[model samples]
Target: MSCFEILDPAFGRFVLGNAALKQLATGFDWVEGPVWFGDAGCLLFSDIPNDKILRYTPGVGISTYRAPSNYSNGHTRDRQGRLVSCEHGTRRVTRTELDGSITVIADSYQGKSLNSPNDVVVKSDGSIWFTDPHYGIGSNYEGFAADQELPCNVYRIDPDGTIEAVLTDFNCPNGLAFSPDETLLYVADTGRMYQDDPAHIRRFSMESGRPKSLGIFHTIAPGKGDGIRCDMDGNLWSSAGDGVHCIAPDGHLMGKILVPEKVSNICFGGRAKHQLYITATTSLYAITLNRVGAQTP
Candidate 1:
């Protein structure tokens, strides 16, 4: 089978003709949250069901980074180079301090506990945005099953330590990422959790500190978008049932890099951020890309 399905000719520029998707590691229960640490020359990802965070080094292979990670799902580095995480077990967004202590950013809004924090992204101004869905709390696999006290909403934690609900209309918002220039924010709404069909991703324009849904960004044909990241050119690479779907800045289909297993999340790492690391169902995959990923900072 072809390794990629390029919808537009422009998609050809981001991929290599001889680059094949390689499974870096496997045998985990559920793998997600792949983040590259260029400074450490390693990659860290979560195996949610196993409650572990695994690390992969260049010469070395996979090793347990942290066990009992509190079911960390999504991860990204902040402006200060701290790891920001969305924890399902704790139902909160946390920042991994330089000394490795966990600092709670948000747990409850208006005295009501959050449902489950899924994905997170740090903005340029040090504000944190994350999706709080019931995915982690809905079952006993990822986290302890519990009642959802708050509705599934996309929230923003200001630099001043104030929490605000930016958008409260999603059924279960999943992955989220900002555009290369921070002009737009894309969020995935996996309707499967609500038994809804035709799962789609939405793009919101950030002009006045308020986000308004511009419209549907892109719709996956046979799968749903789970985790998404943007390349330097504002091309969004989102996790699909088949693999990762690359969407253009104009919300047009770019192409897909097929993975053997269903992918959950992805991030750009490696020296120049040209390597794409993916977290699939039970494995971790990576491939070198001709184009580099958009810098979150």
Candidate 2:
């Protein structure tokens, strides 16, 4: 069967190649939140249902990076090269220091515990941003059942260890990332948790260390996106049920890389930042792309 195709039409000829969709690992409940560590030459992702974080290398396959990971959902590297994670089970954002020690960056705001940290990103200025929804507390599936006392919001943790709310009033915030220039922020509204439709990606202008002038970017699948990243050219790569959709900066659908299972999250890594690692349901996949990823930190 053919897995590659190049379309010729009135617009132009665009090539869609399946150069990498092989499953390197399997037998997980649900996989999400992939991040690339070029220095370590490996990819790390969260398997929420399994309550673990897994690491994958080209030749070594998959290995346990962390267990009882507090049901971490999203991950990214900080400007200082530390691992920043959003913990659903713990209802907080955490970081892993160089010595393998964990630090709670943000857990409670205004003396009340957060709902559930879903996704996270670190700006070039060393500010850690993350999303909080009730996914972790709504049920006992991903995290412990607890009372949600605050509105769903996005927060920024400053270098001095201060947490500031950036945006509030979202049904549920899922995937998120800053543009290559760090001037714009994108977030996926995967509303209605595990349902169809009502799925849209939104964009906000980042100014003076906050988000402003929010708007819609694009929509994905019968479901919404989970994790998101940007390429060097400013194009967005988002996780979708069908595969990974590469959308242009202007919100045009360019093409897709198909996966046998539904994709939950993705990140760019490899020696040249040209590799796209995908976290799909029950498996992990990767491909070498022609473009580099943005240096968020």
Candidate 3:
């Protein structure tokens, strides 16, 4: 009964073979984003179809952080420890201020409405990066059903409040993360969700405000790449239909942590930032790992 499926020797050393996988909570409708707040001693995740954000504290169990969450999908914390989120129902990105107020990061570009903000990450420099896809608008289950008005792409919100489409040619951008030093960006395209499209992750070098594409990093088959994160050693951890896949810094599949449900997102948290929190269909699960995320708690 190993907790991990080690596909590479390096990954065997990366994950504890005996560390048990724990299900923290259940009974949610489609959990997608999971972010750990070490300062608050709790983990926050979205139950998208329910349009709510649930907080899971070790002793207190699960509670509502925010109801009517605008169908938030992805979340991350800025360097200042503020909450940055992507709202699928609202088709916009938002930031929760210290005073508990919400600031709109971006909802439109060039006078055109965004499709739906999906996954997001914050750079050390305070710039906000997020994916825009039509998944939310494709139906009324997770969001208000409406017509899409923009291409499926990834965007960057500048520190000064300017918004620009950094990657414009995605079939369906779903997940994104930065390399350990912020020199490289990894974005996943789950085009396979439709018409046998390529389900792969792409790499880019961040330069000149418009990053240069390094090319496809890895092509996933029989599954698709969803929410993703980078470890301190620069390995990319991605969500798949089967479980969580760990790919090497050089784009080789290293290993996987198999979950019973389809995994949507992942984050590194817990007291030591060595806990890998996973968001699956209707549950939140965690396992202790020997690695740390690129961003610290």
Candidate 4:
């Protein structure tokens, strides 16, 4: 049985035949928000229902990075190499400073409490962008069930501490990433909870730090995309029900990486950034590829 499912001939050059998908860890209710810390040689991810953050090292195995993590769901590193996280329990975005202190990034917009912050990404200019959906507060499984105070929207926090809602038309914005050159922003909308809503990824053109919508980029079938990342070649790797779907820059489905569990999120990590780390329902998986992830810190 082959793990690779080549849908397009172009995907052949991106995968390595010698590479195998390895399950790094398991025994979690749900896992998401994987971020690679190259400086520390570790990968930190959230076990949402468990309310803990787990760290994985190549040889050391899995360990608890942080417990009672406020139900964090997504994470990324800032330009300073600090950890930026989206917390579902607290319904806010936060940053873990180098000195071991936690700083609140954003919790509200225009005096109204925000929904749960799902996924986040940092720009080269130090801006923090994230998606706020009601998923976290909609149930007691992943977070404290509560009423949503604001609409699901995407927001950006400026380096100087000002926060603004950047996009407001998503049914539920889940994952997000930037192109290698930072010219394009790809965001996943997993609003399948509502009948008739299509599960898709939307592309936005970035201009002077603002996004101009380019409409639906691609739609995922067999399940929806919850998290997404981009490789150096501008190919977007998205977490799907069947596994992981690779979409080209022109919005074409290139291929799929089959996994035993449904993938929730992914990040490019490992020494040379040639490895793709995936967070699925109950396990963490990784596979080496011929491509390098887009440079982001």
User: Model 4: runs farther than 4 Å from truth?
Assistant: 192-196
Those runs of model 2 whose alpha carbons end farther than 4 Å from true positions after fitting are 1-18, 194-197
lDDT of 4 by residue, 78-195 (tens): 8889999999888899999999899999999999999999999999888899999899998898999999899899999999999999999999999999999999999999983445
Report backbone clashes per prediction: 1, 0, 0, 0
| Evaluation by lDDT, superior candidate among 1 and 3 | 3
Q: Residues 1-297, candidate 3, lDDT per residue (tens digit)?
A: 776888899888888867889998999889988999999999999999999999999888999999999999999999989999899888999999999999999999899989889999998888899999888988899899898788998998889998888899999999999999888999999872346677899999988656799999997644788999998999999998888999998888999998999999999998888999999999999999999877757
Predictions: Cα RMSD each? 1.3, 2.5, 1.2, 1.0
Ranking by lDDT: 4, 3, 1, 2
Q: For each candidate, give its TM-score against the true structure.
A: 0.97, 0.92, 0.97, 0.98
lDDT of each: 0.89, 0.82, 0.90, 0.92
Candidate ordering by TM-score (highest first): 4, 3, 1, 2
Measured by TM-score, how close is model 4 to the native structure? 0.98
Q: Tens-digit lDDT track for model 2 on 1-297?
A: 533222223112222255546687899988888888878878889999789999988788889999989998899999788899999888989999999999999999999899999999888898888999788898888888888888788888999999988788678888889998899999887874555547788999987878885688988764467788988778888888778777778887777777778888888887888777888888888777767888642
